[model samples]
Target: MAGGLGSKKVDITWSTEESGLLMAISVKTINFKDGKTRNYQKNLTNRRGDLLMEAVTLHRRFPYSVLAAFFFLDAGAENDGTPKRRSTFLNAHARLKLFTDRSDPAGREEQFERFYLILLEASPNSVSVRPFKVGDPDNEVSLSQMLDEILELVAERNPDFYEFDDGRLIKL
Candidate 1:
């Protein structure tokens, strides 16, 4: 994709011949713990910066495009820290709150339309995924719910083309 600053590759994107760019999602992950901190927060700031840069680059060229960001962390991040200290998960939510919820095309270019924090727990058998928004960290959502919300946001942003109904997208 051609961005305001330069060309960039997004993880996932949706577009049409009629519309240039409808939606884009950027995914980032921090899977390992910091040796000193014993937490998965060593690259939190760098990840945030990368996300902000991506948002700006994309949104500047396509203001009407819906941009979503997904940050992944190890499930252990939820409990990493001292008893009196806030967990890395909670801290990430607080740090990310300001960068999400860009509801309008004219909104800040650095803000993403949606941001999700995903914690992954992997074992020999299977992997568990828990996703949540910044403001509602306690209310984790399933993968289906996350996809539904993103599609709904896309429909909301482009009402003339798509409509979200009954947990599905209806094209107009």
Candidate 2:
């Protein structure tokens, strides 16, 4: 969509003729470790910049739009640190907290409505997905739960048009 800074593409979106861009989700992933640091922290700043820019662009164009950011890291990122240092996962949550929870359209242009961190574990046998919000790092949920939260946020933002009910969105 055309945004404050030219054009931007979002991973997922929900819109309507009456409401323009109601919701958008931007997904970013850092699946590999840095060659030198041997950690996922190397590209952390760059990813955050990208997310911030996207939020500004989208929010500026559609002030009421609900912007959600989903950042994915390898499960091993949870252990990518020395005994005295914090893991990349924890550090990411701390950094992201400042840029999330933009509850109002008049809020900061670079802040997203919601932010989620997902840790993915893939093996030859099966795959596991653990997701958590920026504020609640200790508790993890399944992918479905993360999506449900996003949907609920959307309903909350557009209460006159949508309502969250019975684990789903109901149009009123």
Candidate 3:
């Protein structure tokens, strides 16, 4: 219902009377190419911008909601007829780190909560989720860990609402 800061829509969101806006998520995917690093980075930044504005508006109403981004980066490309370029995985990660550098400082004072970038690799037969998180470069954890963090964040505001244990979401 709100529009601005390029936030035509929020990718994912949740609400409850107790927590108000609760959570808002932005999802972006990058299929890495050689020299299109800047372009891909710009695309992600644009999505991030959208998430920020939406979060701000929601937070103004709820005051306890949080914004998050889940970025999916393709580490390998199938023979999808696209031109092959030397991958800039490190550069891509750095650009995302820049995204956090801009957001995290304000996150503490605002509604932003967490960032999850899942690096995916495919071999035309199998794909896997190697999850990464912002705020800590050395942090590496499973998808369950990621969900647990979300639970913790929400728990901070809705302490009596739910519990997350061993990947199970328990409602109270």
Candidate 4:
């Protein structure tokens, strides 16, 4: 995608809630003649509250460029010297159950679809998604990856939920 004619490649570097995860995304938008590049958005936090939601919006024009938007949670910056806390036992259990559920395919599918679409709506040219990987629950995960995992797990639990290939959400 890089070093190509009429290829719009964007590179961005941003952090996640936990100190361990950050994002470096490169998206290529193929236009008619030329392309553009820019950093979209990034979040840095310690996993104490809701993570920031990063999105991109494209301008309405030929060879349109994109802009990144960061949606912060009620909690502020991760390095704001705030003490870290753990989620309640029920909250943790509920999340796990939702991910592991295999019976309610419709519900899981709906939840997953909504989650990813929200991200897509926020982003300008989100042609693909990357799942987040964390060694531990306390570890920070990339916002992109976190959303990706939810999409994957939902599809795994219920094949009919969505039609995505290789992290790229497709119309199937």
Give one digit per residue, the lDDT tens place, for model 1 in 1-172: 9999998889999988888889999999999999988999899999999999999999999999989988999999999978877888999999999999898899999999889999999899999989998667899877788788889988988899999999999999
Candidates' TM-scores? 0.94, 0.93, 0.66, 0.25
RMSD of each: 1.3, 1.4, 5.6, 17.2
Which candidate achieves the best lDDT against the true structure? 1
| lDDT of each candidate versus the true structure | 0.91, 0.90, 0.57, 0.27
Runs in model 2 with CA error above 4 Å? none
Q: Supply the TM-score for candidate 4.
A: 0.25
Separate clash counts for every candidate: 0, 0, 0, 8
Residue pairs clashing in model 2 are none
lDDT of 2: 0.90
Per-residue lDDT tens digits for candidate 2, residues 47-105, read: 99999999999999999999999999999999998877788999999999999989888
TM-score of candidate 2 relative to the true fold: 0.93
Which segments of model 1 are wrong by more than 4 Å?
none
Lowest-sum lDDT 10-residue window in model 3? 77-86
- The candidate maximizing TM-score is 1
What TM-score does structure 1 among the candidates reach?
Answer: 0.94
- 113-172 in candidate 4: lDDT tens per residue? 112111111236544322212113233446666446544543443344335468754433
Predictions ranked by TM-score, top down?
1, 2, 3, 4
Candidate 4: which pairs clash? 15-43, 17-45, 17-46, 56-122, 56-123, 56-124, 131-145, 132-145
